[model samples]
Target: MRISALAAEAGLPVATVKYYLREGLLQPGTATSATQASYDEHHLRRLRLVRALTGPVGLSVQQARSVLQLVDEPGDDLYSTLGRAVGALPPDGAEPAGADDPYPRARAALEALGQVYDPEFAAVAQLEGALAAADDAGMPITPERLARYGSAAADLAAYDLERMPPEPHAAVEYTVLGTALYEPVLLALRRLAHQDAAVRRLGREA
Candidate 1:
C-alpha cells in the first residue's frame, strides 16, 4: 500500500504519519518515486500501536519510540516492558515513608509487595500505604488481608498481560477493546456482588 493508504488504514492523518516516519517511530517505507513511498502492513500496524501508546496513554513521542523499540525487539518481554513503563509514571504523593518516621510498618508492607509483585519499589509502597490507610479508616481490609489480595491481584495481572497478542496491531486492538469493555464488565461484577450479598443476608435471617 501507499503512504496515503497506510495513513488511512491506521486512522492517522498523512502529516502525522509522515511526522512519525521522521521521528523514527515508524520505519521508512520503500521509495517508489522521488516523492512517493509504498508502505506495507507492518508499517500500518506499527503506526497504530504508536498512536495508542502516545494518545490515550500520554507517552511522549520519545517514550512511544522507546516502547516501539521494545515491541520490535525479537527477544524482549512485553510484560516486563509494560511494567517498566507503568513504573515510570509519577508517584502518587509524599514519599512512601517519611524520613524521620520511627515506624517501619509502611516500609515493610511496601518491601513485601515489591518482593511479591516485582513492581517498582515506590509504586508498591504507594499501593501498600493506600491499602493500609483504607483499612485504618475501617474499609474492612487489614494489612495481612491486603497482602493476600495483592498476591491474587498479581496473578490476575500477569495472566492478562500474558494473554495480550505479540503483534503490534493485535496489541493495539487489545488495548482498545480492553478500555472499551472493562468498565462495563466490572460494573456487572459489582452488581452481582450486591445481589449475592442481599440474597445471603435474607437467607441468614430466614
Candidate 2:
C-alpha cells in the first residue's frame, strides 16, 4: 500500500499522513523507487494509534510521541514501563501541595487500602492535589469514602489487568489505550449510576 492507500485505510488525509511521517509520529514506509514506498499493516496500525492519541485521546504531538516512545522501547521492568506510560497522561495541572499538603491524607488512605504505590507517582500527586482542594472547599473526602472508592478502583484495575496482553510492547499499548479510551465510559457510567441511585433512594418520580 502506498501512503494514499494507508491514509485512506486509516480514515485520515494524505497530507495528515505525511505530516505524521514528518513529525516522526508515523514511520516512513519501505522505499520502492526514487519517490515511491509501500506501507503494510504495521504502518496502518500505528497510524490508527497515532490518530487515537491525537484525536479522541486528545494528547499533543509531543505527548503522543512520548507514549509511542514508551511502547517502542519498553524497558525490562514492566512496572516502570507502565508507570511511565501512565505518567504521560494529561494531569490536573496541580503542583504538589506544600507544608499543609493533603498528600499525607492520600498516603494514609492508600495505606489503609493496602495499595502499594510510588509516593512520587503522578497519580499520587493528583490525589493529593484533589484532597487539598476538597479540604479547602470544606468537602474533604472522609477516610471511609476514600476506602470505598479505593476498593472499587482496585477491582477495576484488576479487571483491566486481567485482559492485558502478554507481550511487553502490546501490554504497554493496551494499558495506555485502555486508560485513555475507557476512562470516559467509566465516568459516564458513574454519573448514570448516581442518577439511578438518587432516584431509587430518594423516592424521586422520574
Candidate 3:
C-alpha cells in the first residue's frame, strides 16, 4: 500500500502519518520511486501500535518514541524493555521506597507470599508514593495491610500474566498495553468496593 492507504488503514490522516515518518517514529517504506513508496502489513501494525501508545496509553510523542525504540530493538530483553517503559512514565509523587518505608515492607510481604518481583522496578514508585500519601494523611500503613495489598496485587499479576503471550515481543506489548488500559478498570472497581464498604460499615456514602 501507499502512504494514503497506510494512513487510512491505521485510521489516521495522511498528514499525521507523514508527521510520524518525518519524526522517525515510522520506518521508511520501500522506495518504489523518488516520490512513491510501498508499505506492508508490518508498517500498518507498527502504525497501529504507535497510535495505541500516543492515544489510549497517553504517552507524549517523545515518550512513545522511547518506548517504541525499545520495542523495535530485536536484541532487547522483554522484561527489561517493559521496565524501561514503566520507568519512562512520570512519577506519581513517588520516589523509590526507603529501607524503612512501607513500600519496601509491602514488597517484602509480597515475597513472603511467594510472589517475588523487583522491588526496585520503576513502576513501584506508584506504591511508594501511595505509602507516602498515607503517611501524610496521618494514617500510616501497617505491615499487615501492605502484606494483604501485596498478596492481592500478586493475584492480579498472576491473572494478567496468564493472558500474556509466550513470545517476548508479544509479551512486552501485552505488558505495556494491559498496564495502561486496565488501570481505569482497577480504579473503578476500587471506587465501587469503597462505596460498598462505606455503606455497609458507616451507613452512608463516602
Best by TM-score: 2
Model 3, 1-206: lDDT tens per residue?
99999999999999999999998999999999999999999999889988988887788999888878776672546667778776765545465545565366446545666754565676566765676678899998787777787678878988998998877777776777788878778989999999999888989546
Question: In model 1, which regions exceed 4 Å deviation?
Answer: 74-83, 89-107, 110-122, 125-141, 144-148, 161-206
Better of 1 and 3 by lDDT: 3
User: TM-score of each candidate?
Assistant: 0.62, 0.92, 0.78
Q: Write the per-residue lDDT of candidate 2 for residues 1-206, one digit (tens) a residue.
A: 99899999999999999999999999889999999999999999999999999988989999999999999999899889898898888665356556554367667777888988556677887877778789999999988888899888989999999999999999999999999899999999999999999988998656
Looking at model 1, report the run of 10 residues with the lowest lDDT sum.
Answer: 87-96
User: Which is the leading candidate under lDDT?
Assistant: 2
Cα lDDT, all candidates: 0.66, 0.88, 0.78
Residue 73, candidate 2: C-alpha displacement in angstroms: 0.7
